[model samples]
Target chain A: MKKLLLLLAIAAFCMPTWSADTKNLKYVDGTTLTIINKPQHDGNRLRRINTDKYPDLTSRVRHYLNMPTGMALRFRTNSPVIRAKWTTLDTLRHTNMASISEKGLDLYIKQDGKWLWAGFGNPKFEGTKHASTMINDMDTTMKECMLYLPTFMQVNSIEIGVAPDSRIESCGDIKRAPVVAMGSSYTHGSGTSRAGMAWPAQLSRMLGVDIANYGTSGQQKMEQFFADIICDTDADMFIFDCFSNPSPKEIHERFAPFVKKIRSKHPSTPLVFLETVDREWKNFDLKKRKFENDKEQAAREEIAKVIANDPNIYFFEPGLYTGTDHETSVDGTHPGDMGYQRAAINIAEKINATPALKKIIDAAKAKDCCKSPCKCPASKK
Target chain B: MKKLLLLLAIAAFCMPTWSADTKNLKYVDGTTLTIINKPQHDGNRLRRINTDKYPDLTSRVRHYLNMPTGMALRFRTNSPVIRAKWTTLDTLRHTNMASISEKGLDLYIKQDGKWLWAGFGNPKFEGTKHASTMINDMDTTMKECMLYLPTFMQVNSIEIGVAPDSRIESCGDIKRAPVVAMGSSYTHGSGTSRAGMAWPAQLSRMLGVDIANYGTSGQQKMEQFFADIICDTDADMFIFDCFSNPSPKEIHERFAPFVKKIRSKHPSTPLVFLETVDREWKNFDLKKRKFENDKEQAAREEIAKVIANDPNIYFFEPGLYTGTDHETSVDGTHPGDMGYQRAAINIAEKINATPALKKIIDAAKAKDCCKSPCKCPASKK
Candidate 1:
């Protein structure tokens, strides 16, 4: 059995899924999807903004929402492009400099030549009688974008030192919540920034659970990828969706071993295996006579069956939705809300119906017996 | 002097700019910014997508799009993960499944299993059906989001194909037009699925010149990536705004290398560099520190200047709007229309002001120049 497994592993390693090469590329016309993973620092600074501050930017406001103190302020020419190091605070600022009426604004400037920087601070943002030298002048459009509103004059610094009490609470100490989806960029919550649309993100919203997304584009299948995902964070449940790369035989060899390794560590954790379907599959390239589509789908099914023997392993098939039926997917592959709803429904139903969940919920009820989202204390009540 | 130059070169190499390490980590909240190089397909069947029939989508839409086809559309069913596979017409006959469609309607379906995939074909979608599914099967709040008019379908196939004509069109074939932006996700106009909002789409409206978008997401910096952009396609002034990565060093090392490589070969094609920016820096833990913020910006400027010496390498700075400024960024990084419009203005201004551009415009005025969507040649001309 060991030898056979080794052979299978080697077989999986041999077959690589290379995307078909094309001469003419159809660049999908859509918004570039970005992943925002930076933690915001609520620096306690008011003047931290050298650029005009718009109150409506919630993300920005959120960063500074918990600011503990005031910020340090810096000044520059109209643009953030500090042309020459601030030899002296040049009083020459944008015309909107008049808006700095809250305080006086005047400074001297000098450039030996090389670069630009913000030097001495102007205590007053507005002062009438100061004629300052302008460095690289701001252009016309710059005027338009600033909307005639005054820019905050260069840069600002805000100090946000945290108290000893406020820090990343350890998951073990705090009854860790297990609701993170781990996978590739697909799970990273790509597109829907407005609504936060990645499948896992949508799932998080639907389930009302905090989903720690451990997805990175182009990093799927790397051994280190999963090691970090499993070892770095703690979660109650893990929706395993790593089927994008592994070849047919490879999945068979890997799934059993990987799941076994995970089970040893997280013996009781509900590990749900999610198989993905690509929109490109529907694009029709192969000969149907050979049941090429079925061959591929069968391959996926075989992998599912291979893992299905374990009663704890929950397997999902991508049925139930009327495909291509709704204008739900922005790209035929990635679904929009219609797709989101379908995904939520399918996932939640399966989760709710699971015996493992029933056991956990029942056990929790027997102990604390509060409503859902209950705090399951570890006092052995 | 040579030793000094060598010392300077070594100093430049040893002096690193980016200290932010993005190593083994799931995500960093707002700080994660991933920029795709000029990505292209590395496979064959997928290339079928570029056919002229689906001129926009590429010719082999069915194969490239990865949608399902045929009568039965044999989808795998078992442990019940509905992944795609082509079942025979007889299979469809047995199942009574027909075509797939993405149209005006909502979708909601919950599976009793772990996950579900919609069939290749979309079922009849009535607005009420989706609402009913959400209300009954989904959490009330989640259901509310399910209802919306369809924007665009996730694409699958293009109906066009290009039959090759051996005639070689060199850089000399290019007409010096105002400005044409090329390369992957950086250029092919993205941001929204809507046509008007794409940077190129929007810029063409502003510049009164056709600013073509060659950007495709998930792009990689590769020779194959530029193959079609150079030979199969033509542009006047070109802006390569890919500096978001492949790093500055990569840009300096490969960009000119590629240009010189392309130049050593093509010799006369004009190329410009558009620097990529990450607005996630605004929310960085140290953003309140003016010095840190300026360092990142300065690094971008430094890289810009390194190559700025070449007259043809026009540097397009990321407009002053940080990712936060444009709340429209789906991921606090990819610009939204408001962001794109802002970006377009910067590039448009540069292109219009170039003396080389002035020369091209003058030559055009001397000709008949009344062609609609003028088929202006590329630079070598």
Candidate 2:
């Protein structure tokens, strides 16, 4: 009996601590993960811009700021399975946009120098709190990963789960300066099917630099407070997709001051203005055509004046952002995932075409190269 | 007092019968309109395939058939405004698909020689009954139009409204035979943002022929009953997207019998089989990769035997139906609108490239020439 008891105790001591069941997985607070694509990490880590810092902004703009449009959490882990539990501030839903893009999470794994989509976290139908198993059953290799937050809903709390014995750690911040984008619903990812497919997120992955999104839905009307926020942001470049929502009169009144305020703070930072893509519904509605044409003309006039005066400022007319087929939009106004992809590539091409913009992006890339122990000139300096 | 009353009565009688307010707009039952892209009108006008005709089908297949996958209402009207009121059979919602694509109505207007998207009817967030103004403030020119029904929800009742004084009439059925498509959720527009963006609908518009959709969601397993329905369908061509849902063993057991059953009824009908698309998630999940590879190999082996014996049968492997960039799907398995667009174009190209298929399509076009006064050979006959 003594010998048997001793053998049982020895076996118990040698048993492994972890189990394969996902219920045994350990969860880490999302805030502890490396939050990326934000101009400043002052208030909520999930939100793109802090509302408390600018109290004078319109209530609508402040509300929209609470939603994380293009934010992502970066981490490294060797766990084969990943899970997420989160609560949205409001269980908001849209008719034309999928709930996965509006309030759920999207996961991407970095494989061999490229980030590929791995899985999606599906949101509950009618609830604020939701949980989903993102991906499972893979060889446990240390992999860098990104989890994109909700594009059109605010987050209250989030937790990421990994295997009990796996190593998980934050991927620290990117050393290079980020590109700041301010715009309307198109930039807010209104018609995309996943959060990571948003144009700003696509631009970041394509350029290998951070692109902080400050899209405010229908509230991006070139407000002075927005200019105040943009001017103070730490960025290598600024892009404005702000021409779509404001009235022609408002554009005429606010365009010059908005540009001047940003220039006053960061005079040498490259600024790019994008003309609004023509809405598909305008083809049949003459009234909308005239209204949009007037707005476009006003934007062109203001941009022409700014471009002539400032050598660092550049303007790009709408290219094949949404293809010429006129079948890319969901509600005749908001472009779907395909349009967003085309828009990202078109914007990148435009940036590469200009020497000034290319120089700024190249400089940022050089700074990124200095992160490792190397003999590169940037590292040596 | 009597004189004043008489004058009031006279004024009331002189007033026009029609009012500009949409509240006063007259409603027409959707069934009164010309229904298009149906194989046989034996049961419910909205459903793709009637359950009563195929009692042997699985309950899941029967349930999916109740949803109006690609049915449309054809009409002509001279109204400045168009509106719709509908009650869905069940107010269903999906997390990964938008409500607009699941339950809402999409309107297209024929202009010159092409059908162009005019507007979309947004469904109520949490209700069975919904009403919306699809379009307003257009010139009162007589226009032919198509209104695509919900792709994933069944309709209990639907009514189209127009200005009280406007002329509205049915635009009778097309003279040419429809192309019948049988498949899974992709053909049912699972990832598309609107009902009209489904691949079958896109194929119809691109080819200028009616293409009846018989998609049954996750239940398209190449069943013997499905073969009975397809064999009886009045079609110029039959397309099978049936290899996705079945297991390799099921395919080995059912594929030859399923094809042979259809061929038994129609000896010379052109039959086309589409190989299942490679799921994007398989690229990362090795288990799924092997499983899907096995299924594909089974399909190829079975198809090789059929093609060797039959000359009228054709097979198409997965092409660039979704672009190579791997960013076109909403879920890893289902293609979004861009992917559907690519699939439609690719399928159309394949059909035109083949002499046997092109000859059949051309014959259908020639028959369509008899619609009006003409000197064409088909019209003379």
Candidate 3:
């Protein structure tokens, strides 16, 4: 008996000294928190088009089913790892989109005050299923972090996990009012390498604000459906880049109603309008060149009349997409990563320069998300 | 017979006016052509690490097998469409890379003096047989264009196709000198959304130059084998971003020798050395902070000595990555698309400003590849 006890003691001595302690984990609803690109929705069935009133159109307008395209959540955590549990309704069919789209959750954190991308929690399957993903090797001391929700998937609920003992809290200071973008496939993130490279996503990163992407591919005709949905949706700012999908007649007819309807609902919110980029072969193709020029002229005239009395509306006469060179687009129509980057920088600069939008930006800065000494180069710059 | 003729005539008349013409199909040895990232060798066996001498290390060094990490081709075609046929030796297991990386070809064209993203020639698989990939709808009038090679596959040979009447010519005035990048996975394009988003590819687009990405994933130990290979490889400029993989001790021991060897061989060739970015969570973790600072200091000291007397060599201290906020990285180590963009812009700007590089760039611009009225926003800007 004594010998057996001695053997047991020896076995115990050979074991590892430290133990992995499971702390009390906490769950936070992404919807209840400040999600960057998510609009105020009735549950996770967030709609860019009013699906409740136009239930018949839900199946036709597939984009409305897609979750907030570039939405992200900023948080503080002291865990060595971040685990997420989610219920995703749909996954993209395109191999490109499926690879980097909203089927996964992309994680970022404030490192030196700038948002640095960690890794993503890739999904395991394609449909509505309870799946979990995680970033396992995180620095335990990490405090400030951000989580980008799926770009093309409808997330029913998301639960973020830290060490049981560690806590996950909402980023209180960074209050992001929705910045709504209404446009065609370019705004819908068609050619982007990932959801985050969309112009709206880039603009959000630059401006440190939330964006609600209301991009409906091939369907941005400034139709009554979009106007009705966008006007009713709560937004701080509205940007229109739908010239690609609308014809001269449609622009002349429907553009004003869309703008006026939004103005009627949110009289105080800022509205920004942009003309389409000059076609890729505009110089070589005279017909295309003429079409592009005429379209811009018509768009400018329409926007001018809509904002004539409204001081809150701003019309930017199409110079922001200057980098639409040979490297900017993925297809003739949709902007790729570089195109998105250029457009975002151009648009963000214009928005920053606008008096009303600039005021909101200044107010956001005053919120002071990072109150402590910032070592981030962005802050220093 | 008359009724049959009538039916055939009806079918022909009803058919679409435009037909996909696969003529003037030329199988130019991609190696002989101005393939950007590929180093000239005995046929398509172009390698960054001289596999002949280090045959034992070939299998161990995985990234050396990755073809066209940043390889691109600049050409002019009026085919209205572009198709490619390649024999890819290896396909990445990762769905993202396999889907978009080596299995695809990214095409861009010179428009208004800037490179524009045209579209990709997506591969069509035929049970391991060499199948063709194509971009069906390009402007037949497109005079100048560029093509980026695969990132993760060893392309044995490639065949470029055009319309029978249209011709494919070299980018006549746009002579591209090789810009060689030596580093780890970041240079190998681990987290980039697409191959073109890699820093080397971006730099090539920005400068209108060829790039040879010799980015070895985790084998940047300043080994004699790599030094020998890099020394012999022809390059106009050399950029070293291998800091992520090398340890502090390795930096202290091998950094100077590596730089010195390259300097000895190509004394006039510009060498750019970089310090690593500040670790994402360095402030939060004291140990990590110390390690990062120490590693950077060691690397700086090594580079400083080598560049002290060499006016041709430029040492860039780490300040390029400012958006490290939480969005710049894929994991704690690799940079994602945004990070790559930030790094590329910084490096490109520095290379542009360097006296030696600026002269070369000026000379390339003087070549006047476009030779047309520049309307591209990049040129205008």
Write down the C-alpha DockQ for each prediction.
Answer: 0.03, 0.52, 0.15
lDDT of 1 at B249: 46
Mind giving the per-residue lDDT tens digits that candidate 1 earns over B17-87?
Answer: 22222221121111011101111222222121133323344322222222111001001111111111111
Error of 3 at A361 (Å): 5.6
**Using DockQ as the measure, which candidate wins?**
2
Question: How would you class the docking of model 3?
Answer: incorrect
TM-score of each: 0.30, 0.90, 0.76
Candidates in order: C-alpha RMSD to true structure: 28.6, 9.6, 11.2
Model 1's CAPRI class?
incorrect
User: Candidate 2: what lDDT?
Assistant: 0.79
| TM-score for candidate 2 | 0.90
Query: Which residue runs does candidate 1 get wrong by more than 4 Å?
Result: A1-175, A222-233, A285-308, A319-323, A326-341, A358-381, B1-161, B165-191, B194-381
Query: Which parts of model 2 are misplaced by more than 4 Å?
Result: A1-20, A173-177, A366-381, B1-20, B173-177, B366-381
Better of 1 and 2 by DockQ: 2
- Return the lDDT, model 1, position B367: 45
* Residue range A2-53, candidate 1, lDDT tens digits: 9768744643443222211222212210111111111111221222221122
Candidate with top lDDT is 2
